[model samples]
Target: MTRLTLPSLAALLTLAACDAPADGPVQDPEPAERLATGPLTPAGPAQTVTADADVNLQHAAAVVELDEIQGQGTLTAKLFGTAGGDPAMNGLYVHAAFFLSPAEGWRVFRIGDVLDYRVLSTGPGRVELEIDESVMDPETSEIGSRTRRMILGWAPGAEGAPPETVTVTPAQ
Candidate 1:
């Protein structure tokens, strides 16, 4: 079975960090017209959590914080787990949180209780997260993974309004 060692995983994380936008928000290439959404092609590696862990143990596997344009606020992506029940029930969940103003508070939404997810790319107010689904071989008792992309869009409210919209859709 293939295993992700700490050194290798660290290296991958480092490479991912380098791909993040540094100057400003990168404009999304997709057109504004939303298509008939469905699952996109699976891409990237899977972020897996052992299902043989202790209950009540929580772990933040990955966290990415990006500053949006002046008034757009901040977008944070996290892959975390809180194994409070059965050890076999441990999972890596994906979530996005948007913060505009102190008065507005942070808007949070759960992407999914996926096996894991990777931050594919980020922009001004958008994040592309790849959902990593795990597959198990009954005969071999081995686990494998497949990845599909999803976009988390956080649009700013008009005229500095407190309410903003967050959407999760299959990435093109």
Candidate 2:
């Protein structure tokens, strides 16, 4: 038979003290105060507007705005074949990236890519997209599903003039 040492006996006593009587009633503490009631009221009055107020508002808005590309965009490059053919692939699929203007760099995209804005469909000379600008949930990383349509098209022009004139419009 093993004899309990002083330290071991003290540890056992400590553990026994920690455990509540099994037959005792379990009392749950009262529910916490409902901290979240409804939309919170602003803490103070709105800031005074000044001549530069519009500029300040624009600067704040720009932080969340999507980078807009010019209308003269094109499906300038494509990636095909197996997954290895493109660095942006998720699996075996490959997709095309575009250039809004020849002077602008490429905007890379892959099939079924969902972003703040997404490419809904793509074809030879046109690309359709949906953009959402609603508030997002910080906890779950979810955003409202409301969206607006955007269509991009390439129009061919005569010689000596620009070969392509890109147009961006909302889908009817």
Candidate 3:
């Protein structure tokens, strides 16, 4: 056996620790091979997802379901007190608001106003929301308003779907 110098020994150790070359022929990546198998088979099936991917996908779908509700128009209508309160004002305010007006903003509408409100889900199949009477001095508007949560139905019944109407009255 030949005597080895420190430098030579270090170099030999480095070579021995290097990663090995392909055992034989280069194999196709799992994903690529999966894709080549058949159209019915998913190249990257959810079942085979890494723990991170599974967790992230579960969260991402929930977010998408949540975001779907913003599309409906703004306009809220709810019969809070009594149905016979006023036939004319019976339906939603003629004008509707999809999004809530600023904490204090004014949108004028006739009492008999009818507007399509986006209903929100409160419980399974059932829905509920409170209408807050924004800062509207009674002196400014004809009728004083109050905000109360009104239980309503979500039409076409589906999770995360918008409501048929939402009711908003100026704060009393």
Model 3 residue runs over 4 Å out of place are 1-121, 133-142, 154-172
* RMSD, candidate 3, Å: 20.8
The stretch of ten residues in a row with the least summed lDDT in candidate 3 is 62-71
Comparing 1 and 2 on TM-score, the stronger one: 1
Task: Write one digit per residue (lDDT tens) for candidate 3, span 23-79.
Answer: 699876799788887668456747654456566566334221011223233433222
Order of candidate numbers by TM-score, starting with the best: 1, 2, 3
lDDT score, candidate 3, position 146: 47
Highest lDDT, which number?
1
Off by over 4 Å in 1: 1-90, 100-104, 135-144, 159-163
lDDT of each: 0.58, 0.49, 0.40
Q: Write candidate 2's Cα lDDT for 49-159 as tens digits.
A: 656656656634433223333343333443221223222222233233454456765454443322245657666566676654454567987654446787755543433
Deviation in Å, model 3, residue 79 alpha carbon: 16
Per-residue lDDT value at 122 in model 2:
68
Scored by lDDT, model 1 comes in at 0.58
What TM-score, to 2 decimals, does candidate 2 have? 0.27
Winner by lDDT between candidate 3 and candidate 1:
1
Backbone collision count in every prediction? Answer: 0, 1, 24
Off by over 4 Å in 2: 1-115, 134-146, 156-163
For model 3 the local lDDT of residue 12 reads: 93
